[model samples]
Target: MYTLNANEAKTKFGAMLMKVQSEPVEIIKNGSPVAVVVSLDEYNKIEQLKMELVKSRFENIDESDLVDGKTFREELNAGKYD
Candidate 1:
């Protein structure tokens, strides 16, 4: 991981992007951390793992706990997985 102040990040934006390919970059503002920059592949891998973890957590739930049909479909498509 790498850390950079906001001003330094802005001044070396392109170079920072290249650096992110190897590891995440933390951006700080007002002397505190604010954001992280990661490569697209890294972001995708993280999201996929998150989704899988969410799914696994529900695997042991009883069928009675789930809503029926249309309502379930609606919630499923409404970003409820996250």
Candidate 2:
């Protein structure tokens, strides 16, 4: 990862964007880390990994563990997910 303070990132946005084509860039503000800039290819790979993980988990579930849509919605509205 490459690191840049907020001011540097703002002033050198084009350079930072170019750097991210090869590796991720870390952005900091007030001496604290705030964000990462990655190439679209990297971002898409991450999203694909997330989807695969979710699909694998769902595949492992038993039908008995499944909830109907209405019941799931009711539980969700009751803050069960929170």
Candidate 3:
């Protein structure tokens, strides 16, 4: 990871962003870490992983029954089991 103070980051924003594209970079303010910058590919990979996790978690649900059923809130309040 690379650390950049506010002034340094402000004066060299483009270079800092380029550095982050190769690895992680940390922006600091008042001697404390404030934020992280990551490459777009890394960000996209994280988003894709999240979607896969959500899809797997809901894989057991029957798609046909999802549209056929009453509203979700109604089913929940009715103590229905899938």
Candidate 4:
């Protein structure tokens, strides 16, 4: 972990951001660790993992159960229940 004081972080914000692209950067305030910055690639990987988890929750659902008595427009318009 790379540590940077608040002032240094602010002054070199762009370079610090670039460093975070390779690994995490820790921001310290008053000698205490406050926050972390990570790359977008890492963030998106986490998001994709979350989506996969949500998708897994529906993995066992049958196609018939998913489409039961619902027209495409009715489903699209949120009127399927009626």
Q: Best TM-score goes to which candidate? A: 2
lDDT, candidate 3, 4-78, per-residue tens: 998899999999988988898888999999988899998999899999999997988776656434587787778
TM-score of each: 0.74, 0.81, 0.66, 0.59
State the weakest 10-residue window (summed lDDT) of model 4.
64-73
Prediction RMSDs, each to the true structure: 5.0, 1.9, 5.4, 7.2
User: Scored by CA lDDT, what does every candidate get?
Assistant: 0.95, 0.97, 0.87, 0.86
Model 3 ranges with Cα > 4 A deviation = 61-82
lDDT tens readout by residue for model 2, 1-82: 8999999999999999999999999999999999999999999999999999999989879988899999999999999999
Query: Compared with the true structure, what per-residue lDDT tens digits does model 4 show for residues 15-65?
Result: 998999999889999999898888999889989999999999898887776
Question: Over the stretch 31-70, how does candidate 1's per-residue lDDT look in tens digits?
Answer: 9999999999999999999999999989889977878889
TM value for model 4: 0.59
Structural RMSD, model 1: 5.0
For model 4, what is the C-alpha lDDT against the true structure? 0.86
Q: What are the per-model numbers of colliding residue pairs? A: 0, 0, 0, 0
